[model samples]
Target: MVMAFRKKPTSVIRTKASKPKTPTNWLHLIKPMLMFLCLLFAYVMYSNWSSWLALLDKTPIRAYALTHKTQFTTNSDIRDLLSKEPVLKGYFGQDIQEIKDKFLEIPWIKDVAVRKVYPDRISLTLVEHRPTAIWNQTRFVSAQGVVFDLPKERFNADGLPELYGPDSEAKKVLEAWYKIQKDLESRNLVLKSVAMDIRGSWTITLNNHVELRLGRGDWLPKIDRFVTIFPEIEIPDGKRLSYVDLRYEHGAAVGFISQ
Candidate 1:
């Protein structure tokens, strides 16, 4: 027997939706918006740059101010110093940095720190350099090698050995002199001038112009050996030696200038 199949009926629904495309010119609106944004960004950057430039102009003066520290000091003197220069004033408008630079130019000022204290004022703190020693009769040399005007009162530096020769040898000569001074003090010997030749040879002078020559080689060993042998013998009468040379390995030598 043959089997047969039948198809099922289906229902259809309709919806209304009809609108003609209104010629859209979206590019026109977008182009204007992008241009406006670019112009705004440029203006912002320019304004920020101008503000920074203004700040820089005044930095020198603002830097000169004293910190909000001890009331014993005031900014009047600082303001006077800054106001004297019209060029500097024109460079700094409400800026304290230019003032600071001027203040730093003062010979006595060692260091300065500047701060922006908001609202209406700036603070400046100053550190003045203390004189270490008199340099070559006319100038003053600080512990850090900064040369300045000679102070009125002579500063008596404790145990600082006199420096001579070129500026290049200052550090080395100072160190060696101090070391030798300390050593001599321990041994009850008062050290005076520590002179070094251009060839780096060292000579020590004591009271009454007594010279002790330490030659080119290892000086500490030579000095040690001299110290050991120094006390043993007595010099012949009326023949005082001018200097003791410890350069030789076997023994020491003496120098005397005959008048």
Candidate 2:
């Protein structure tokens, strides 16, 4: 009977697998978190607003005014008001950024900063532009070439070279002329005038009206060679040399004054 009896067929059941969670659907979990954060932020803002308003209501305006004619006593009064406990407010009447912008607009002020103290006082720092030289006949030029003008009585530049030329050429000519003057100093000679031709050629006149023509190429070597030969040349009696042409490759030519 046991051999004849077959085991009952087991019931077979297939169950569907659960789907994998995608990050896109999981984003719903952050909604509650964001709502909580927003509520907390609102509460904090309300608290700070109430505190600031109460402090401002008690602050004194007359004492905080910044006026040029006011005596030092007024400033002391303001300072005393600001030093009170629980951080009295409304002393900084203007926004710090606005105050900084206003100060920067001043002619001499290059930069400025404003800081709020714990109570009511403000701290200020300023940077002024340093005058380097006079630009043209009126404006002052800083070391960085920023031009501004002040009353002549306010500044002085007795020894700075007076530069005159077209606006486009002034800077270039000034730099070139300065270099030429420096080179002249090595020979114990001082240049009187370094005038540029219409074509931008450089012509230098010495103290004695002895002119030199230095054509476009680097003129230092020519100047050096000419300096070596200058002392050797002897001018004819009653004939003063007018111009020395140093543009030639090998030798310098001198134009003599007609006797």
- Candidate that would win on TM-score: 1
Of candidate 2, the 10-residue stretch with the lowest lDDT total is 65-74
Q: Residues 1-259, candidate 2: write the lDDT tens digits.
A: 3557679999766545555554676558898899999999999977777465655644532233342332112345335544444343464343456556655555655665567553555665555666654456565555554555555665576655444334456556567767988999988887766655556777777877788888777879878877888888899999988888998898899888966
| Clash count of each predicted structure | 21, 0
Candidate RMSDs in order: 7.4, 11.8
Task: Flag clash pairs in model 2.
Answer: none
- For model 1 the local lDDT of residue 27 reads 100
Error of 2 at 68 (Å): 18
TM-score of each: 0.58, 0.45
